[model samples]
Target: MADPSSQNPTLTTPPPPSSSLSPTPQSGTSELSPPPCSALSFLKTANRPKLRVTSEFDSDSLLFLNKVSCKLFDNLAKLKLSFQNNSQREVSQPQVSFTSKHVSVLYDIEEKNTFIKSNLDVHPRLQLRAIHNVKAQQGEVAMEANLTEPGYSLELSSPVPIGYPRATLKFPLGEISLQEKEDEEEEKQKRVLSVNGILKRQAMNGICTALYTDEELRLRYAYKDDALSFIPSISLPSNAASFAFKRRFSPSDKLSYWYNFDSNMWSAVYKRTYGKDYKFKAGYDSDVRLGWASLWVGDEAGKVKTTPMKMKVQFMLQVPQDDIKSSVLMFRVKKRWDI
Candidate 1:
């Protein structure tokens, strides 16, 4: 990186003879000549800031976690096996994921809710991630496993939570000022503060901060009443100088809106509940332009449910093209049992 302030060789010119100097009209001092920068300005103007696209996912789609919980293995003492698919794909292209949790309601070894949740990803690449939830009455300490994906380079992490108090004052247009500076080296990242027990886990807590670099994580801060919250965070990679806005009218209300934005992109989403087991979401983004609005109507609807098991069957009409003859008929059935 050569300094732009340095003089350029192509712009240099020989000085005129002293005898050719003309007296200044306003002062005794000789009139200063034009700066060398004017001639070599093209060399500096050639450099331009590069444009960057941050996120790869820029579409509007429905995302749901398909999970089945079974207690058939309760003979193993509160041991449960759960298989979940965490991918956003067509029903024909579902992914594979598994989880196992050992929980005790009355065991006082750690707490009444002493539980260990572990997840394993078997396909695409074998990976494992686990969290230890050591909860008490007021505060809980969570320890995360330091594991890496199967095919990636060796990832060794020793996660130590360095918790602290963070205060934020919000301004309009998603601009914020922080007192506790973002971590400089990003060596030992801390965990973000959460109000899961306090606030019903509706917010993604760290919002009113800046992401200094790629190593520094851009955390989502949870918002409280009057658009105020005190949350801490661990460093994650993000664009610099981004802002988030959170607003909730009431504490007991489940409806909330969150908008996060930086220079490159922005996104906003709001979720509301109709009744107990039904909820819908409406959102828009700068990306995900409107595609052809497709619709599906059919007569395949049957579900059977009891206290211990559930079964559902549906037939969907998939039309990738505008022509009706090109549509494909699909049938799906799901069944699960509990003991």
Candidate 2:
């Protein structure tokens, strides 16, 4: 009699809403979500292709060209086009080259020349290299062995076209240590002595080398230190002697002088570098009675290894003391790119 609906409390209570635990149909998602079209368009842009080109220019009378090169196939190959003056040449020369870790091949379209080089790592301390010229139908094979424990190296090279073989041996003599006394600075310098011996086959008499002799043997001694280097060389039978010296004033400044007793000629050069981007050189030759000054705008050798692209510019002036009118001013610009 106490009301049946009041006795059943569960039945009297209203049912809980279904949308409490899950999102409702009209409400949107609460978590972060990326736009559908943005991801697809981003991938398309990232996979797009690109092209790269390199070029060079020169203002000289060396019968050269203004060359441009295009990289392809992930930079494993290059196609080059060389342009020259119409008065000098008719058509541009095209060149192609392919390179890999152990081999390289190059071909010239106009000259119909091909060059191939292969390097083999036979052992940890031994290496072999072979070079072939298609046009000349000639080849050369070279081997190098390094004995690090004794500080000795051996190199042998032989020509396939001709029976000319050569061998060179290099070894360290000893080292002398010296200390400098200064008020505020103390430095230790090492004087390293090394020797080089070269032996050539008798058939190589007609070939030109540093020293020519009937015994086909040459010896050179090198002494190097932190700030000074001296190299004295002599040949057997001919006994032709040459001396070279280099003095370094600082890390960026140096002077080099060399004299050849066999030719009775001497040459000297002074070089100064301004940071890593600029270099200046002045040189004089007694044999030619010529003096030259050169300015380099970039570190050609240093940058090539670390950069994918680089530009180099060089300005040179040559003065012949005997004939001032024969003086020449030359400049060259080179740029390279990798794609």
Candidate 3:
């Protein structure tokens, strides 16, 4: 045998076991110290549970993700198919797709009518209703549209509060006075002649006696040979005789009628027997009187008749005074409307 220890490879010294050590505590009556600890126990005390991070999903999570992805793919495929079908149909057949959809909300509910609300609150407000009236079909809806309608009346009787101050109108009072002037005395009282004129019987073809009685006529001094010929000046007094005219007429007579007079008519005479007033009437005879002659003519009657009868009318200052002025009073004559 050649070197049996070398051939068998026997160790000169045995190796120590792989065991860990730590500081131990002292156990004594004076100062206590703990026993030494093992490295494996220290490792057990220091090591914590490790967390595993992964990107791969679990079965439940994968199922949810698959469901969502499948739904999205199906929707996209349907949309693409629809678009392709629409494109093909559009080329083959003409179709009118009305994108302008009329909203039914813009209608009058109570009135059961539709209207266009151009400025509606939330909507675009461009709304329109049917032009003609029609019974609403099944599932028809009415909208609140027209706030007002024909024959709709509202009366506001109560007073409302206005944000304004109260207003007032105040007037100041003033005084006024008049002074009278003295007139110079006349040197002599002039002599005057009193003339009395009477108006007599008058007739007409087709006229009412009440029309004549109710009618008013005025006389003015048209012209005179001398300005102060008749009793200085015919000063119309303020008495009833100055402004009023009267006539005694029969039941079959009318006083108001026109007359054509010849010139140079004369009075009966100067009399102090002052009648109430001078009365004029249409004459009965066809004879024509003129100027001052007709003014004092007595017992006259209506003569020639005409279709549209006109009253020979004249006006004078009824109350003639130096200070009182005269003005023309107009009466509207009724005319036939047919012509």
Candidate 4:
């Protein structure tokens, strides 16, 4: 406490500023530094399509499902239609059969013969004139020779009745042998048909050319609004032939075709599979088709017999797989038999 003014003369000096301070790192460099990788990232690469994984699902099971889907896709194919005969014969020939051979050919032949016999007595000139007039009105001419009074010329060939003379005679076993022969002949006739029956030639609506079973009858497909439709041909004789048809799809085979069908009652259909069960379905549609019946008689002077025959056409479809079901659309006649 000596003099306060004298103590003020002894004040200390201040310390110097620091020169060793370091510069801060750049913000861009810090942000770009690689981050620590996760355990899952080591297995994931950039090549394949991304796979979703679950705890309970094994990768192998996923791979199996994928493969199955691919196989199924490869097997899917187009649908088609064809025909089969009574001899268990599958013919690729396009034909539509209405009744089976046993029922159709015989019955039709009988019908034709009966019709001819009933009308044979009528004057041919009258019939021809009527037909000719009709054609003339339609602005057309009859291409064949004028049908005139071709008198009762009758001859039965081929399917002729057997043992006519002998069977009629009275003998010990004559009746029994005749009966046996008759049965044999009947069976033979039922089994035999014209391998290449006369083709009924006709021009349909100009779309598809139909090859008729009994004759050359051509039906056409009518195309409208990206849909294919059927147009039946005009038959010369209404009772000439019968038609039949079927449709099927082979997703695995890639096939689709239709033969002779006077009607559109059959169709090829498909559906989505239910599951691993591989279930399927099918269906058919009814579309009318036109056909005809024919009878031919030869000139009377030469003694020619008219062989009247009826042809049956059948249509069917098949698939390779066994697990498919079929659903039908509708069976209808787009056209009718034209006489």
What's the TM-score of every candidate structure?
0.28, 0.59, 0.11, 0.16
Per-residue C-alpha lDDT of model 2 across residues 152-233, encoded as one tens digit per residue: 7777877888744666665563222222222333255443322333332222222223432332556665667789887777
RMSD, candidate 1, Å: 30.4
- What would the per-residue lDDT of candidate 3 be over residues 1-339, giving only the tens digit for each residue? 011111232356854644567334355532233335656665664443221111111221121100000111212211000011121233211111111233222233345543321212333322222322233421211222222443222211111131111111111221111212223344564433222221222233211111011123222221122211111112233211121122224433223222222322222211111132223322222222212212211112221121123122222212222323442222211111111
Candidate 4 minimal-lDDT segment of 10 residues: 64-73
Name the best candidate (by lDDT). 2
Q: Give the TM-score of candidate 2.
A: 0.59
Root mean square deviation (Cα) for candidate 3: 50.9
* Per-residue alpha-carbon lDDT of candidate 1 for residues 1-339, written as tens digits (9 for 90 to 100): 011233334676886755746654465444565556965776565543221111111112323324332222322322222222225443322222222343333223322354344445443333344345446333223222323533222212222244343323222323222223345457875443321111122435433443343334444444455645344333444443444455554442333222334434455544443333223333434343211221212111322343113543334444443355665544444444332
Query: Which model is ahead, 1 or 3, in terms of lDDT?
Result: 1
Model 3, position 233: C-alpha lDDT score: 12
As for lDDT, the candidate ahead, 2 or 4, is 2
lDDT of each: 0.35, 0.69, 0.23, 0.25
Model 2 has a clash total of 0
Whole-model lDDT, model 2? 0.69
Please name the candidate that would achieve the greatest TM-score relative to the true structure: 2
| Model 3, C-alpha of 4: deviation from truth (Å) | 99
How well does candidate 4 score on lDDT at residue 144? 20
The count of residue-pair clashes in candidate 4 stands at 48
Off by over 4 Å in 2: 1-52, 62-93, 118-214, 304-309, 337-339
